[model samples]
Target: MKKQHFLVKQMPPEEIELEKKRAELSILEDDLALKELDLTTLQVVLEDLRRRYLRIVGVKLAQLDGIEAQIAEIIARLDPKNEEVKKEADRRRTQAQESADATGSIAAEEYEAEPFKPSEDLKQLYRDLAKKVHPDLAPDEQARERRHRFMQEVNQAYSERNEDRLRSLLNEWENRPDSVSGEGTGAELIRIIRQIARVHNRIEAISQEVENLKESELYKLKMRVDETQDESRNLLVEMAAEIDGQIEAAIARLKNISQRVEKTERSRTKQRDSKR
Candidate 1:
């Protein structure tokens, strides 16, 4: 048996570090790409799920309405002079009205469901923090530590949905010592701005795609189509389950990557500080 020839190339320290950074960036890029793709796929699946749920709810409500109508007919058959029948009809009417009210509330809640939107203050704070803590700015230990802390604060504020804290953090950054100044600051600021803009643009694009899916005739037709195709409906259910699994997996991967990145950054900062 002939062994496969393995090629080995030796690289300089600088080249090796560059390669490592490139690899890290590439992994992050791939993760983001996968997340975007998964999100798109999930959105379609979610829309299908929504349509199916709506169809089922609509059918149930229609049946309820029909039953209510039948009850009305039965009540009409009883003489108005019959006290027991009149009272029973009143009770049934009240129950039907209550059911209708509850269903309407549910539909309203579903229709009104909206994605979380950070307040203007919070957004401004995030931008400010991004400028300070951006990995590129970590040229020294102190700066790197500041960056890490700022990033932590940014993440915390975002998770808590604390617009006030975000706004305060932005204000603090503006007034803080070691704040970047001049054209250099402007360049760094632009990079941070662009990063946020990219995320927002992506989110908006996804939202529009979701809206398009909802409005699509095919989506509507699918609901009708599903009624006739048991196999297709079953397939959609399977796909939905698969999508959920993918999302959970993606989330786990992201968490692991995030922790690794943070740990690496902290270690690098400590090493740099010790040298100083």
Candidate 2:
């Protein structure tokens, strides 16, 4: 019975150690969950900002350009040698040019920084880091610490959307970290790297599709059509400005609409945030 007692005593210590390890793992899992949720929320905010900026700037600029084009077309149809027509065309042209410049400036201001990094380059960086610091190969505490540092670097680079920093970090990891060999570990690292690469590739493809849609012939034609309409409307205003009453009435109406739209946009934004 003395040998049986020794075995039972040995089992209790192992069980206690197992429970401690499980508790540590639970804490780690909770931390990772919180980090993931924060990351997802940030991504959503970024995407929404991009969409809002594009809609406001792109659509409005297109409308302004269309207005200018229409004014120009109307002016061209008027006989150039006639003093009234000549003066009208010159005035309308100046107004159209001013409107175009304003729209262009707004477009420039609304531009957002492009996506994190091109898929291929980002994937390459991920692969190089995975080779050096993959957790499976880092069996000891010191090695694990190094792996954690490398992973932090990877996440930082991604969050900042800094391709240059990511490339430098990957290069540093490849040069400084201990190398691993053997089929199983290397294969596992490759698999994880490939998964990251696939995600980057998909993001790049989606971005490209969006850009292509924006630049399509149909889109260009619609812009041109709108520009023509705006120009025509502007030329009519220039022509009618010769009649004082009409010019005053039109200016007043435009001012009213502009004020209303501005107020509505502000109210809508406030409502959106409140809902969130």
Candidate 3:
């Protein structure tokens, strides 16, 4: 019995440790893959929601702008002393035109343009980082692709002048803290470890980004749209109805004001005839 047990070849302590590490690494690889998929899904859904929300909100704002401008015009034509109303009409017209230009339609001005000018220091930093991380300098094709992506990030951060992002990228390249893995082929394990680290970073970044997106105005608009969605209910439809009501009321007021003005003019003509 003892000889048979000896012949069974039980794993030694060193081999057991290696086996444990390998299992842990495999689990890490699986986790990294799932996180990547989640990241992609979150990004796509948030972006699509943002676009639809903005489109609906923009169209409604445009309608409001048109109605306001018309009301201002009516008041100006009805009362000669209403110079402020005339100015307001001109301003609203200019704003509406700008909104149209930006959104490729009426009333979407939520997106604002920011100025970007690369400082000399930023440019120099980018050049130094780019040279270091250049794909052509990588030892293997896989590392080369990884470096290529890293360089793209460097270029983008430089273009956007995001100093902090550039610094973080540099830090990551210098330190592969997560590269410690179970015993394996040295180069292969290093590649897997580095990939795992990057995927973890991406998962965190994407998670935070998606969370922030949830707090945005566009997200609220999307929520509103969903809440109002039914066979006979819609947010844009309700907004249009309200604005149409305001427009009708404004037109009625303008007609009444015009009648009063005409009546006053006729009264003055009668007075002039009596004086003659």
Using TM-score, give the best candidate's number.
3
lDDT tens digits, residue span 1-276, model 3: 355444577876656655565566556545543443344334444455544434655555565566666566656766767788788878977877665554564233353232133566665565556545655334456667887788777756765568788788877877853222345455444554554455456557757876887787766766776677644567765765676676677667657766876787899899999999
lDDT of 2 at 51: 43
lDDT of 1: 0.55
lDDT of 2: 0.51
Q: Looking at model 3, which ten-residue stretch has the lowest summed lDDT?
A: 106-115
Q: Which residue pairs clash within candidate 3? A: none
Question: All candidates' lDDT scores?
Answer: 0.55, 0.51, 0.60
**Can you write out model 1's per-residue Cα lDDT over 56-159, one digit (the tens) per residue?**
45434434544554454354443557778777767667766665665554465544232234556554555555544443344445665786687677666664
Error of 2 at 174 (Å): 2.6
Which candidate number has the best lDDT? 3
Off by over 4 Å in 2: 1-117, 177-276
User: In candidate 1, how many Å is residue 183 off?
Assistant: 11
For model 1, what is the alpha-carbon lDDT of residue 6? 88
Residue-by-residue lDDT tens digits, candidate 2, 1-276: 455544433545545555555455444334433333334334433453344333444444344444544444454443345677667666766765665665565566544444333355554555455545444335345666777777777766655556788778877776784644335544544534443443345445545654664576544544453475567643223323344454355455556655666677789899999999
